[model samples]
Target: MRRSVAVRLSALLATGALAAATGMALSTSTASAATGGVTGYATQNGGTTGGAGGQTVRATTGTAIHQALCGRASSSTPIIIQVEGTINHGNTAKVSGSSCNTAAGVIELKQISNVTIVGVGNGAVFDQLGIHIRESRNIIIQNVTVRNVKKSGSPTSNGGDAIGMESGVRNVWVDHATLEASGGESEGYDGLFDMKDNTQYVTLSYSILRNSGRGGLIGSSESDTSNGYVTFHHNLYQNIDSRTPLLRGGVSHIYNNHYKNLNESGINSRAGARAKVDNNYFEDSKDVLGTFYTDAAGYWQVSGNVFDNVTWSSRSGDNNPAGPNPTSNTSVSVPYAYTLDAANCVPSVVSQTAGANKGLKVSDGSCTPQSPDPTDPGPTDPGPTDPDPTDPPTGTNLSLGAGADGSSKASGTSYGNVIDGSTSTYWSPSGSTGSVSVKWGSATKVSKINIRQASGSGTVNSYRVVNQDTGAVLASGSGTGVISFSATSLKKITFEITGASGTPRIAEFETYAS
Candidate 1:
């Protein structure tokens, strides 16, 4: 019965950390329009004074003038608001019928310090949340473009999440934002950036998390042992081929990102959190990478990553292994350069990072410690970038058992993995007691069974799912909660219970049919 480790709902609702007292409460700019510099500042209730038509500030209405023009003043005070038409919750036209979108304000700041939220001209776009910060300090969320629309009859139904920062917020910074296609109910549970818990010194650079069902910068939180120091660099979690379902939280520091056509599992660090990956790049993805078991005290140091036709599944009995150690240390270096479309050849250089290019430094040495001059951009390379089709990367697939009708389509050897008929899939029970059969070959007609009980860190509360020809008893839950089953055609589905008996380990197995 484990399932309690997901804190940082923005610092359990902020109390201290920020306003340590500084100086200069600057606020300039009267009014000027030419397509470049626009500014204005004023935060009455929270008391902030900043002015300047250049640094940036333009909020046209409400949220007490965007908290009197980006409040908090010991430094940082650049605002740019021009949100027109529709506003606040209930979706707000998902970014005002496009013009680049904009509508919704209230970017709070406690401990009051550094603030810079930009998005002028064709810059700001938010049908919902483009930015939302708390307990702020040294903040800077630039080039915004949030699009949390909603209204999807299925297609894996996703909603909510463009940008969200929770309690204990510290040294935050997000650049080049462009979060897209969230789910229904106004895209609430989805994520582009839903960094939770006592977020500390965060930085989601060069952003672009497209059409998310989940997966794209999720620090997660329900509240436990909070201490997030995130830094998901050079972002670009590409097209996301299909299988729209996401869950993985805790620990931070995933480096040099770039994944294309990624289906599921790119970078998940659950169980106890403590990640430190390097030089990333996974293409055509199926399962790029992960470190589960709720990641307790989990340690990682992967290097120079680049797997073109990426496909790898870890977690056998547990203690999932990747390296002896090489994510960082001794000058820092993580390397990668690809060529595996099916071995197209002509792209090699791999290093995990440690002393002068320690492990996996390939380049023809077959990989022994050779990667050093593929152009040299290690020690955290945020240079030489490309991949922005105007922020294009979207795919949502969800399909479960019993011949999922409604224009059914399920293949991959009929669900050994990778299923998506648009999403509404649910299944649990990996404690392993033994039972696995759910085959509705030729038309059996099934009606609904959705369960959810795998919440936070090596999660599990209680488990059970049975319908072997009417043995019925189709529901029983705990912890990460969700159970349902009305009508049943029972194609073939079985899961009997294994570890929750003692708790902790339940590596894989999830079910869903509606």
Candidate 2:
């Protein structure tokens, strides 16, 4: 949204940019793009003040974010668009009014309510657009970046969801977003964030859901159990090949999330859904939490989670998978007030505050990451660019301090990132075969080992050097040099990954004693 608060606010309101104050407060007087209000549970049921004092517009195409919601004045007047650049589907169309009910090329927040679609100056990329939200309620979608949307083959597809909320939806607060989808559902792309009918109190903070093959769902099948009270904090689910969300029934509050890889099955809380998983940091992946295919059953109340090498499959019939171990059958109460932030520092505080334009940074529950509020308006596009790879790694690394589990890392990668010798920080695997271990709580004496790779990732054609307390394989690879193996003493030492050319980033897993 770049200008137009009904005929361009008379020269930006005499040059003061713009400022409004009504129910909450919406001021874009430039302090770097303000939206500093309304916290989680969207603040809770009857509290998701959007437009704030109303009228503070600016939209860069996508039909000006539905023309700042059809020049609001009814249909719950309250506006604050502000977006910028790239909103795909060629300038987007359909902009009726009676206060809006947009169509034609998505980004349509159908049947609106108090609105606010952030992403100021130079950040807001909905390339391959998608942002539905039918029968809206108090809404606020901040920052931005909805990638590769396509619920079906393209032609500027619609419903290929990158953010979809169903009818009767209520209180929705999607902050710092970056919902993505590139391939899955047979390459037609689908679900990066979805909800079915009667969607209820929602909140998805500091987000970043990657790759994709349905990383969303909360009712949409199995008798569509009226979507639950959703809330996922400090998010980041990478390479997802499962519904990091699939709660069928109701209730969800997955805290401090940072699940990496998760190539199949994760937090699928089935039918009678219920989840309150606290302090999460699950890395690698497979069966990260229970109730898969569906036999109707879902309940969780686990706590302080951090399952680093997770992998649990073998429940047969309907395929349950709460992983090698995941307890709590049910008991969740959360009525507001939140603070948890230490599931092993949730992957470095969700890679410095999850998706969309980092300046929306948040997470001061002490694991750090809280900047942006210096009056607002930060982030003029400072994204991408990781992979400084000059390929560094030279001598006796001994896997640094040791202990760095793995089986699937990919969300912003970090199984301590291969000993931290920093090849600009690397360690990916959540796809082309997986494994990356370097443990040591005792016994550590290898006979040379160095795998330094990571200068553009993927290309470890074949590997295996385990001996993790005895499964034994000591050496057997075809890439990433120096694998001598003939002097042993181990507390744990693996590299597994049996073949790749695409999902391999390990910068250094050096363990030497020769």
Candidate 3:
């Protein structure tokens, strides 16, 4: 019941031959107001327009008002489609420029609401979807930047998660945009932006998720008490992999931010979702193999952070159980873990060369023990079956010195504090002969030691730890020879000085676990 075609231009005040048809009817009926808020009416020759009074019905060609607002638009009367420039592949929009490979989501806002598709200037890269909001609610997609959303081919399980809110589309917000490398082939493809379906208050703040194929941020809800509320603050998650295992889900909050080179597992809590990984700085990544459960991933809680050179591997479960189980022992987990404020934060190893990896050793501090310790019932508290002469007193040994052979040393003076050298060899100057020679090759469990400054070159001055069956001394420090001990049973493990009192040589001997 509303119709009006105000083409009443008073004839351009006809003074000179009708002033050129009223200056082309004042340049096509003056309506002009487009930069998202949309308003552009211009009709001349066929002059009889009307949807009428609330004049929005104008067309230059965005597919004829997208088929006159398909399905008559509801969800509180939301039907605003404003697109200025660039929907590449070769340019085309609103169905046909390939209607998104014959259509799946070019603009599938099915059950729409306060649907706002604003983009003026730098916007539009719907190689697939610049907007897909299905079963929509108060949906708001701000400052848009979504390029190459490729997929119309190759898809097996997990074929890239660019924007799949597959389940039920709920309160979603994707702000300040830039979603690059729009994943499509597999490995979960790329960052599926802000997905929802079993939804809740979801917010992805200030975004710029690059190389989006295997992960920048992702969430899911299969139901382990499915109450999903994800918040990834001040964003930027770079080069993720294994197709991307970050942000698996469990009521999330991943703060501050900057994660580069993440091949896998930066943060992937699942099923029982309560993932709160704070502060944030996960550098040069790789090796978070899998497991931080919910739908049964791994009970989570990892705080305050700074993981430089991060690498942690643990993912084994299956009970054929007849022998050992310290809590499923996937060879004990590492790269880092914490407690802080309440006390218990250890991580400062990185001395290299101990590659078969069983982890945990530093028998005492400011490290220096390429391999030494094994005297018999030595590290005290002997009770349970008594064999502890450095190690071999228990199970789980990962063999180092446990591969046995002798000629070790350490000293101050007991005929001359010894570590004769030989048995494991190769430190040469003659096995670097004694002022205090310490080298033994088969005693396990030396709970944590770190004497840095030897990566390519070297540096470590004054170091001490002796017992080699009692030439005693036990602990000494000088300069950067950092220290800590308590796993005694030595035959030889010695280092006295090098570089950095002047800096030219090398020194780095590390071990951990108790």
Candidate 4:
């Protein structure tokens, strides 16, 4: 969504911030209830059942949350803690008990098992705070926003990660959460999400990680290669400089993710890391899948991934490009069954389904088309050369600025550049808020528009296609690519960018009538 929403949510979770309490009200009475079992890839490899068949508890402040979780009399029993409002550690004092010991700065889930921490209602946010999952098993963290947890500052926890797991952690599933950082190490910010110290069987799904120096990492150090078997799917990694994430060593299944504007690196699979990279959309990124930094090396089994305008480092020691020409030494076998959406459809599918507050829209791992096949044609005699009068004419490209002219409200490199066929040339909009429109002398029937971006940095996150003459929105959604809608006859069509993470560059605005 919009950056303003994220900013407002962060502000609402800040210290001394307004307590616009949302979600389930705090309830003292505990209810014994059994929730559903864990789903998705989490069900594989012994399965993950977080708080299944357990009591439901409610907590408001950070201290209350710690009490509800760590103060439990029986640690083996499953529990679902519904968190409401902002749980900023700054608002709560240090909580100490026989079962738990937590500092004032963060909420620690230490030596806990079979627990699910989920935000409810308008959703819960943790501002300037970190959630540390240590020595835990069968855990789930969902529907929360964690932002600006600094690493170098005082009161920092979990190495400044929005969510971090380590030391015998297993079967931890993080879903539908937004994790962000203001800046990189220079800004005292660390990874949005990180796992280390023998952590295994973890899955991060339907999450948004943006504007950070490091997205996440599988292992902590080069020699620390015991952590692995992590799955990252249906996530959005945007506007980050690098490490989208940095996998030191592990067997990671990375698929169906939208990686945009990765300035430094995307997926750094190194130190014998084996990643099954499939059906991911990488735009404007550099060295998306490769072994970087150390020459100890990594392996990637890459397939069906769309690398649009992605630049690669030279093929050298540890600087190997993934796929087309891979330097990986080994291949990984994925144990679980999962369907993959085509890489071309990743931008559209991920923009509609990824991140928190999305109502948990996940694919069912069935990409097979439901339509029936047409019957085979019988042997037939050759027909006449003349075309049938009843048949419609095959559509053609309506030349821009000839029968149609292009214009924009905001100045760009050149409005005409968008219509130019050369992908090397592009029209860079001065600001995020702008519209490029094409008007024809007469009404033309159009069905589809293909938006070609210069690189990942120039990709649009959200936009709308409007029929300018009738002021009708033909289609509206997020991400750049081919946008298809009902065939409409219009004299003027405009593509308006409503929200974007970066300054978008349109290489070609190709219109098709079919």
Model 1: CA > 4 A from native: 1-65, 70-113, 116-139, 142-172, 175-178, 182-203, 206-208, 212-255, 258-278, 285-303, 310-514
lDDT of 3 at 58: 19
Question: Runs in model 3 with CA error above 4 Å?
Answer: 1-125, 134-190, 196-210, 213-267, 274-285, 289-514
Better of 1 and 4 by TM-score: 4
Q: Which stretches of candidate 2 lie above 4 Å from their native place? A: 1-55, 58-67, 71-100, 103-131, 134-140, 143-173, 176-204, 207-244, 247-255, 258-266, 269-288, 295-316, 324-361, 364-366, 373-514
Q: For model 4, how big is the CA root-mean-square deviation? A: 16.5
Full candidate order by TM-score, most accurate first = 4, 2, 1, 3
Report the error of model 1 at residue 199, Å: 26
Clashing pairs in 4: 283-456, 284-456, 401-404
Per-candidate RMSD vs. true structure?
Answer: 23.8, 24.0, 31.8, 16.5
Per-residue C-alpha lDDT of model 1 across residues 335-437, encoded as one tens digit per residue:
2222221111212222122111011122322322232231332211211111111322232112244332111212311223222332233333233222334
Ranking under lDDT, best-scoring first? 2, 4, 1, 3
lDDT per residue (tens digit) for residues 110-154 in model 4: 887877787654457888889998988888787688989988976
Q: What is the per-residue lDDT of model 2 for residues 386-478, given as tens digits with 9 covering 90 to 100?
A: 112233335567888787887788888888878977778887887877888888888977766777777787775445566666444444423
Q: lDDT of all the models against the reference?
A: 0.38, 0.73, 0.35, 0.68
Decoy 3 TM-score against native:
0.23
Q: What C-alpha lDDT, on a 0 to 100 scale, does residue 459 get in candidate 1?
A: 37
